[model samples]
Target: MQVSGTFLAFAVLSLLTIGGAVFMISFTRVVHMVISLGVTFLSIAGLFVLLEAEFVAISQILVYSGAISILMLFGIMLTKHDAKDEGVSKANKGWLSILVVAVFFVIAFWGIQSTPWVAPPDNAAAVQEDNATQLGVEIFTRFVIPFELTSVLLLVALVGAIILAKKEEDNE
Candidate 1:
């Protein structure tokens, strides 16, 4: 099979994304985990761009990479996390973990095999250029309330974090 530039890029990004997720789970530090999560989000965003979903790509970058990542980092900084507390986590349910992973693997494999994928049109010139514009307009008109609610949700989370981070007065 002839290898294409898009296929090569997709393969590299897929490896980076999987590696990031694995490293994120393996990291002991909360900050390292958040950064690794950002890597996975970034690679997914690149995948969206590759699929020609520009609006989704930009939204992924803004929401996942820009906002969610910063929020996580801020939350980590606010919490009293000690390096000595890192080893507190241990794998307690070995069989359950394996069972859950096996179930998900079977479901994903079945889904992939069952799905019918259509090949793209050979005439690339037939594609329209106003997809992003149409998506933006629809979002503003139809999904404006949900979009605003998401902002409100983020604000509420920030406030909750601040409340959690507040310390009691110390008696000397």
Candidate 2:
């Protein structure tokens, strides 16, 4: 039997996403890791499209692949690091770190399995029409304070990053 296009697309995107994540973690160079992260974000955006979430897909592409990836690349460039350190950073206690991760995964898996999840009703068409307007209104009117505060927080972080990037001897 021939497989459906949607299922095939989903499988390809899923594999790509997982591969990207693995590459992102395994890559030693900061630039390579950031590029891998972009791959993951783009694949996830494709998955959102497959799920008929056009707004979410666009947001994922714009916010994650476009903005966040660029931000991460800039952050990497702004920070000082020795070019000779080509190897990926490793924890001193590798076994303990692995055990902690395993335990965390077990707890997360148990929580996921035990949770009662309710699937939203499939009214994609209805939601699609007003989603943008609703989202904008809520963000501006209801969540304006939080939104502005986040802007301030980002500004502070940017200033802090700039400050950190400066060499003390150069400053003098």
Candidate 3:
């Protein structure tokens, strides 16, 4: 009974996550898109919880929902178009989009359902016994360079956005 309930919860969250992602990408309003992205991040955190990855779940909520979403919202505000405006209509190929998305979803669902998953042997499972500690050690030791590089990349992106959004002064 409990297992079924958990399974149902996971399924619902998964759908919510996908829906949120679609809303984020499809909506023209930047604020609405950011809110939808928040929903997606929160749903992903819930999924991590359902998978028993408590540390990862907490980090997902903290980093993505807390930091990344706020950063995106700030970026939108900095762009000088914070107020909602019915801007020029772009090309809307609704039927083509629908067909493409439907085909992609069908193929993805079929692949996921058809795949066979096997659990590791009992002895090998010991590798996960202290997952949080092991994960921390690996991140700091083995993956430290990549982690630092990602931080640098984020910083560069922030600077680029700021430069792009700045207004040029007219020289008399």
Per-residue accuracy of model 2 over 12-126 as CA lDDT, tens digit each: 9999999999998778777888889999999999998887767788999999999999987777676754222355257667677878899999999999999999977888457
The digit string of per-residue lDDT tens for model 1 on 1-172 reads: 8999999999999998999999987898778888999999999999988888888989999999999999877767766554322543457676678788999999999999999988878786345356688777888999999999999998998899778777867837
lDDT of 3: 0.86
Error of 2 at 26 (Å): 2.4
Task: List model 3 lDDT by residue over 1-172, tens digit each.
Answer: 2568888998899999999998877787889988999999999999998876778999999999999999888878877566454543444666667788899999999999999978868887567666689889999999999999999999999999888777778747
Better of 2 and 3 by lDDT: 3
Ranking by TM-score: 1, 2, 3
TM-score-superior candidate, 2 or 3: 2
List the pairs of residues colliding in candidate 1: none
Task: For model 3, give the 10-residue run with minimal summed lDDT.
Answer: 82-91
TM-score computed on alpha carbons, candidate 2: 0.72
> Which pairs of residues collide in candidate 2?
none
Listed in order, each prediction's TM-score against the native is 0.74, 0.72, 0.71
Poorly placed runs, candidate 1 (over 4 Å): 81-92, 119-128, 141-172
Tell me how many clashing residue pairs each candidate has. 0, 0, 0
